[model samples]
Target chain A: MSAKMSAATYPLSGPAKVEINEVAPRDGLQIEPFIVPTEGKVAFVNALARCGFARIEATSFTSARAIPALADAEAVMHQVERVAGVGLTVLVPNLRGLERALSCRPDEVNLVMSSSETHNRANLRMTREQSQAQLLAMIAEAGKAGVPVNVSLSTVFGCPFEGDVSEAEVMRLAKAFADAGAAGITLCDTTGMAYPNQVAALCETFQRALPKTGLTIHLHNTRGMGLANAIAAWQTGVTRFDAAAGGLGGCPYAPGASGNVSTEELVHMFASMGVDTGVELGALLDVVAGVSDLVQRDVSSQLLRAGPRLRTHQPPAWMEEFFAKA
Target chain B: MSAKMSAATYPLSGPAKVEINEVAPRDGLQIEPFIVPTEGKVAFVNALARCGFARIEATSFTSARAIPALADAEAVMHQVERVAGVGLTVLVPNLRGLERALSCRPDEVNLVMSSSETHNRANLRMTREQSQAQLLAMIAEAGKAGVPVNVSLSTVFGCPFEGDVSEAEVMRLAKAFADAGAAGITLCDTTGMAYPNQVAALCETFQRALPKTGLTIHLHNTRGMGLANAIAAWQTGVTRFDAAAGGLGGCPYAPGASGNVSTEELVHMFASMGVDTGVELGALLDVVAGVSDLVQRDVSSQLLRAGPRLRTHQPPAWMEEFFAKA
Candidate 1:
């Protein structure tokens, strides 16, 4: 069969290149029980910076009392090696967090809220309206400082506390943020409840609603649908994604669920499909090795264990002998 | 924002229903370090039978010397409860295995061989030519006994030892078997080497080549592309899939690789997409739990850990109290 037939057979065509936004330092490290040392964190971010990622969410400027693991966010941001092409994005939860992040001159600032009121209150300790107002203000504040903002709207697919987050609600928030000067809007699958169809539908809607705004999909592999959702989103023309090294960072509320989609696995999938991720698989894997060592445990990355798809193995001795006889 | 736009946005459309073939008994148990008791194996098969799978590959009729884990295949087959609608398929390697499987009067007989010459020799201890002759003969013999045969073409995607088994070779072998009266063919990703584009391409090619023959895709999650490949195959209109409960069953040759595409996770994905899988997700999860208990360890099923997508959780106590104050 011709390659044309294969491409035609697939429903949605993907872009020539996808932009991977590395979120390990901020999202992955935020939920760890033990904090990674400031120096180790710096080294990790610096290693990721060299891997050709379009952006690395280096750290979150949230209160030290709230998230102790990223208490040294400022230190990590200041110390990490800044490559010319790779943008360093930092999470800013509020005006206070934005001020802290601004002092470091972040390349991009990420704001956070939730589509589900219950999840917003449970996660951010505020009502959805209150969180939206706060995030919108942060976006305007960051815009004044000439820093672009990407708002990560959590539970855009579904909420653990409340069953379904309506599509209209998600669209409303996304449009509101995009109109209010946010450069990007990331639809976050906070607890990994997003399915492939839901991802495609919402991605299609968000892309249509805010055609100029950069859209990113942040997914979790909690139900083993992370890569599937990623593929669906990509097919629907989403070019930006948020993934964590070693698949770190999970919601504490979703017991037994896995963390973010592994950066290596996602890049590997796109690369295997002949789609350019602009990230070197080998260099990215080497960085994951460091993440694993720093975590002091096996992280949930499949590629780390299985190797790449093209990695070859030696035939068993008996098989060789049998083949010789043949 | 309409549902029609969402459906239209998605590239290849999916069928309203899909068939799931449960392979935990034969594929999953065959590679386990410890053999489950015959009674336990019977109980496991019986549980899966109730979960609405179109077919259950109960056991292999291989020699006791070759696969000790499935040595009691006949005993288990005779004792297990056979639900009327569920077809019981047993793996038959050659004439001898086919004779043994025929005695049980199985609903279907599954024949297996590797597409790669080296994998064929290593796995079956015979050259590709020898395996083709043997399996074709078995298919003829099984047809004489009025038992349908499905040839499971191992390493159709890629071979761990040989690597990059040519698609032309896979197509040549599949066409050979289908021309020889095999009722069905299963493309096995022996090492989880199949990616989405490759799967869609091959599925489209195979369907066009043998439109009358039943086509099934068997996948492994070794590199975390299991569900993504499945979605691709479904989009290409190949409805039959082979999955294992708890994602049990892996290729011993691909060291450190995970097992088959998870049955529960696959079912959950299709169900979430508004496709009818016939199988009840809750019942399948229960069966997976039983499989885990029988194996005496955790199986790699994501749904078992995360629960179903709509399973709601109560907000944290502190959050609830805070909301109460609000």
Candidate 2:
């Protein structure tokens, strides 16, 4: 696309490149109405790995009854061809989920619980303390198994059923995750409540408080602020973010719609701003096409319709003639 | 919904409230396939005024042949109930459009031109200077007629037909507008080509250059960056933004689909971030619903379906029971 440059150009402020965690196979598809076959899921993930994605959240090991869409999570986890550097993450809600996830030998396990007292009970069917205690046990198991662990704390910004969340509580949860040996901590907006200022403020605080821990912000476009929040986070010194292929929300079945902040959109934004994503964007589009085929519907990608920003077209006849004369 | 507060309560690092100029009447309807009757257009403008939008770009006075959707612009302008505080702006291309628009007594006239030479030629059928010189003359005419004038410079960020735009070129155009007795200046993304950093950078530059001029960032979400760019501009101290009720683009004889940033979505984002937007979120939703009906399809709005971030639902039975036990 003519609208974007290959790179931002040498020099200038901002990180040299930002890392994107592709969560479409896991997060995007988890809530999809139809379950994509595990073979297709594996092929899809393997394709994403070749696109130079440093990390891919391949699947979630929740109950088959709870999330039948990801019922073959173990198969997808085992079948996706692991690349040399790409990290494969599977969402493990409880110890049982972690144990099932471990049997398939995932590169990393994502332990999730909401920060809100009410949401944790609703989503995980356990109190915050109970979930945390169990996650600590899972972390101990994961550490021994030589697999790193991360925690996704939902409602860190706001909750759907709850009105607002306190920054103090969020900080406490992040601190707990750091103390519990989480390889990284992800601040999940849960319902797209994040704004740029809040993102900047939280990232600033997290960097100061947990200097050793890597920080990731998972955002939803439910309110259409995903890319905006991502840019703010990136500008505020955050380097890792979770995004879906079509920006599909985690969906009603999973959490929310993984959201439609389509990964293509983020890649386009970073590339245009000269921020390196280390992704073959053209190849990724093919992957998106494959995804659209599997979903049997259009994915929430704007670039697919508009082409790249740099894309140009000949002016219409009247305009061309008028300009030609002038 | 309970997800949004009536107004932002606490002080924020950025401007407490941002000004939103509803552009659906002109920008949104222009691209629409069918020409709405004058009474519907009048009612639409009247309703937007009641929703607390201080400025509404009511209609464009382009030739009927050029843009049939707004052919009855004069009738709509004269028929709409005039709200005292609302500034109703009409887009006028040259002296002829300006003259016809003056007969209808618009509050403001917006003269638009593209910054890139190729786009300027294709879109306006004139050299950049020719368009600017004519706009200066129109400004003089509007000044004599006691109508304030503003200029909308398109492709200030990037052009689909051309490539990237020069900041120098954009600054020069702004300066010309300043010297032409224009009351305000709007930097339009045209085809959704703006990036947040570039938006922040350009607004900062323009502010330094034209301290007295009122600046507005008119963005399109074509690339899904409309809200992102708008937030960046607001944080950088550019308070005013132009948005459509349903993220409609400037379509010509289309039912409606422009991809401009949705006004309701922006209001929700600002409110959620504790930034006040004088517009009532609930009343604006009514407007979005109305627009969706007029377009005969769901408009490109997310919150219209998702409701506000503070919106709450009863906890699921399982979660309620789990929490009750605790």
Best candidate (score: lDDT): 1
Share of native interface contacts present in candidate 1: 0.65
Off by over 4 Å in 2: A1-13, A253-260, B1-12, B251-257, B322-326
Candidate 2 lDDT for residue A232: 70
Task: Identify the leading candidate in terms of TM-score.
Answer: 1
Best by DockQ: 1
* Residue B157 CA displacement from its true place in model 1, Å: 1.1
For candidate 2, write residues A40-152 as lDDT tens digits.
Answer: 89898999999998799999999999999999987887788989889898999877888898899888899888899888877777888998888889889898888999998
TM-score values for chain B across all models: 0.95, 0.92
Cα-based RMSD of the predictions, in order?
Answer: 3.0, 4.4
The CAPRI-style docking tier of model 2 reads acceptable
Give the TM-score of each candidate: 0.96, 0.93
lDDT of 2 by residue, B1-326 (tens): 01332233221245776778999988878877767778878888988999888799999999998988899988898788889888899999989999899999988899999888877876787889899899989989999999989899988888776778899999999998898788899998888778877887888888888988889899887777888888778756777889989787653211111477889889888877777778999998988888867866666467777787777767776765556677
